[model samples]
Target: MRTKVAIIGAGPSGLLLGQLLARAGIDNIVLERRTPDYVLSRIRAGVLEQGMVDLLDEAGVGARLHREGLVHEGFALSFGGAGHRIDLKRLSGGKVVTVYGQTEVTKDLMEARAAAGLTTIYEAESVTLIDWETSSPRVRWVKDGLAQELTCDFIAGCDGFHGVSRATVPSTAIRNFERVYPFGWLGILSETPPVDHELIYVNHPDGFALCSMRNPMLSRYYVQCRFDDKVDDWSDERFWDALKSRLHGEAAERLVTGPSIEKSIAPLRSFVAEPMRFGNLFLAGDAAHIVPPTGAKGLNLAASDVRYLSSALIEHYDTGSAAALDRYSEQALARVWKAERFSWWMTSILHRFPETGGFGQRIQQAELDYLVGSEAAMTALAENYVGLPY
Candidate 1:
């Protein structure tokens, strides 16, 4: 089979790119190594930058999002046993974020793709990219015990960090930078009303905790844990007790506890692979970079990458100019580095470090105090939180 673009991985990044390219009269095929159900079942970050929301609108998949997504003009930051609010909208010149699950976004994209009859190969096994350096690149995979190949003008590597897309790049051709945090986030999804109408981020002596919600009744909460911690080590009662200990005042008093519907632990890390483009192949999303979830930049960063890539590809097809395509890696990396910095900074200020000792804790407290007390500092945080310009 031959196409204009061959996309590896049917995650949100791949699906969003495929939708945008298809709507722009570009032919693309998406290949996924997992089944549709497995893809949708994966829980991920829900916060959406205005830029991402607008992209969804452009792709014709924002109706449900606009209807169901919760809008937050501000979020609470707790330190010194008190909650402080950052006016994201006011500080960011009337910008706000939408709280919508990443799962829902994927579902919407999948529905749109199916309705438009776009080609997506699900449950494809052993997918590999061949001849990426050549003008005519191809993706090979097994479907139903039969070998198949797809040739395309360009290839999009939207697969996650562990996928084959990045693995295809030679070590010498790319430079990798990574920092793995010593702790992880132990999160729980419960069917109880959130303690606060807006999300609350807590920095306490115990650790960092976040109070986020999927809807009015579906709440998602997290508390920092050691790298060696296990989900089975904590029960619903223990988790709730620990989370409450980090919160203060009304936040702790108003919290509602319930049986967890889903629980998992996610490690924190910041990583980036430079030069997202490798000859005719380009990497997007987790294939090229990763950020700690502290600033909620993961999905937003992926959306920004998609925005740059789709525009570049569309420009190439429309004007027959490879300028944008040639500069794709440089352009994407500029924004990637900024998001990485913000995620790293947020993680540092909010989480407890094992070796930071008392001095480090005091420094973190002073930073938070300055951030909440100073308008400039607050504005900076709000700008990054709502998302930097795409």
Candidate 2:
């Protein structure tokens, strides 16, 4: 079989890319190694930058998001027993973030693809990208113990950090930069109202904690844990107490406790591979880079990569102009690096690092103090939070 594009990975990035290209009359096929249910079961961050929201709308899947997603004008940064609100809308010139889970975004895109009669192969095994360096590229995979091959104009490697796409590239051809944090986030989901309407990012001597939510009745919370910490070590009561201890004032008093429905530990890291475009095989989302969830930039970065890529491909097919395609790597990296800086900064100031010593702790406090006190700093925070221009 053949298509204009052979997209590996049916996660948000691949699905979103397929939707955008299909809408433009580009024939494509998506191959995912996991089942649809398995994909949706993966819980992820919910903060949606204005740009990603707009892109989802452009993909014809924002209806449910607008209907059920929470819109926040600002979020609070809690430090030194005080909570300070950064008015995102005002500080970012009337911009706001929508709190819709990544799972929901993927679901919406999945439904849109199904409704449009698009093809997505689930449980595709051993997916491989071949001949991406030439004018034609082919994707090969196994399904039902049968080997299948597809010829395509291009291949989109959206299969994520562990998938076969990026690994298929010759190591010497790609340059990598990575920083793994010393701690991981031990998180839980509970059927309880959130501690506050807006998200709260906490900074305490003990560690960092974040109060986030999936909906009105579902709260998602996380606390920093040592690299060796495991979920079995944290019970519901212990987790609740830890969370309460980190919060301040009303936030602490208003916190609700309940049994955890889900628990996991996610290690933090900042990774990027230079030159996102490897000939005709273009990388987007986790397949290309990863950002600590501090800035809530992971999914949004992938969507932004989609934005640049789709426009470039559309430009290529529409006017036979490879100019945008030629600039995809450089253009996408410019934005990717800026986001990396912001994510790294957020992680540095908001989390406890014993290695930073007491001096680093003092600096963190000072940074938070200055950020909340100065309009310039607050505006900068707000702008980055709401998202920079696409």
Q: Write the per-residue lDDT of candidate 2 for residues 246-303, one digit (tens) a residue.
A: 9998999999999999999999999999889999999999999999999799999999
Residue-level lDDT of model 1, residues 1-390, one tens digit each, is: 999999999999999999999999999999999999999999899999999999999999999999999999999999998989999999999999999999999999999999999999999999999999999999999999999999999999999999999999999999999999999999999999999999999999999999999999999999999998999998999999999999998899999999999999999999999889999999999999999999899999999999999999999999999999998999999999999999999999999999999999999999999999999999999999998897
**Total clashing pairs for each candidate:** 0, 0
* Residue pairs whose backbone atoms clash in candidate 1: none
Cα error of candidate 1 at position 330, Å: 0.7
TM-score of candidate 2 relative to the true fold? 0.99
Q: Which segments of candidate 2 are over 4 A away from where they belong?
A: none
The runs of at least 3 residues in candidate 1 whose Cα sits more than 4 Å from the true structure, single-residue gaps closed, are: none
- lDDT, each prediction: 0.96, 0.95
